[model samples]
Target: MNIIVTRPKEDGSPLKEKLETMGHRVILMPLLRIVPRPRAFIRKLPYQAIVITSANGIRALSGHTELKSIRMLTVGPQSMKAAKEAGFLKVEAHGDLVGLATHIRKTLNLTAGP
Candidate 1:
């Protein structure tokens, strides 16, 4: 089978390797680039928890001093691992966005608001 992975080089390389090992032709054509923004102060606000859908978000916030202090709710195992590696002490993982929202709604009882 032929596969074209549009993810960035850093992300697609491993997948390409794995696919090739499985006898698949993989093409690397990165569709997006990850650019880390300059560090900024995360305002101290009264919020129940922080929700992250991607590992990139965790990477973006990794340098922040406040990352370890907040409770993190993330979608998927990779995002959970990234959050933990980024020094997030309290982290929860869900299968997808819907699951994350359900967990938040049931456990945190938060329908809306910051």
Candidate 2:
């Protein structure tokens, strides 16, 4: 089988290696690049939980210590792990954005302000 991995290089490497070991030909064609932006002073915002849809978002937010204490809702396992590694103590992994939103809607009241 021939597999084309469109994830970023760092993310695709392990999967490519695994697929190769499984007797499949893998091609890495990164679809996106993560570029860190200049540090910005983040103000304290009223939110129940921080929602992240991508591992890149976790990486981008890693330098912002203000969000460390807030709960995180990530879209996938990899993003969840990344959030944890980035010092998020409270993290939840959902299969997709809709799932995350549904979980949040059910778990929290909008009137409570996160």
Candidate 3:
């Protein structure tokens, strides 16, 4: 099958090898790029938790002292995997944003307009 792997180019390379080994043709079209935040920039946030939807977010936040204390809510298995690999210990797998938002609303006990 002609499979299109849309992960970032660097990450996509590994998947491509695995897919090729499985006899599937892989196309690498990265839909996003990961740019890390400056180390100095991380010193300014007062966040309680980190919300990450992409693996790029994991790469961006890696090795920052500020994030060490913040819990993480990540979308899908891949992002969760990346976040964990990037040293996040307190991570929540939220599946997708819509589901995450629903979970957040419930967890926070937020109600819709009356």
RMSD of each: 1.9, 1.9, 4.2
lDDT of each: 0.86, 0.87, 0.78
Clashing pairs in 3: none
How well does each candidate superpose onto the true structure, as a TM-score? Answer: 0.85, 0.84, 0.71
- TM-score, model 2 to reference: 0.84
User: In model 1, which regions exceed 4 Å deviation?
Assistant: 111-113
- Give per-residue CA lDDT, model 2, range 25-103, as digits (tens): 9999999887778886666778788889987788888988888889899988889998999999899898888898899
Query: Which candidate achieves the best lDDT against the true structure?
Result: 2
lDDT at position 19, candidate 3:
98
Off by over 4 Å in 3: 14-22, 29-33, 43-46, 109-114
Task: List the candidates ranked by TM-score, beginning with the highest.
Answer: 1, 2, 3
Q: List model 1 lDDT by residue over 1-114, tens digit each.
A: 999999888778978999999999999999999998899777877668889988778888888866577888999888898788889899989899999989988878465545
Once fitted onto the true fold, the runs of candidate 2 whose alpha carbons sit more than 4 angstroms away are 111-114
Candidate 3 structure, TM-score to reference? 0.71
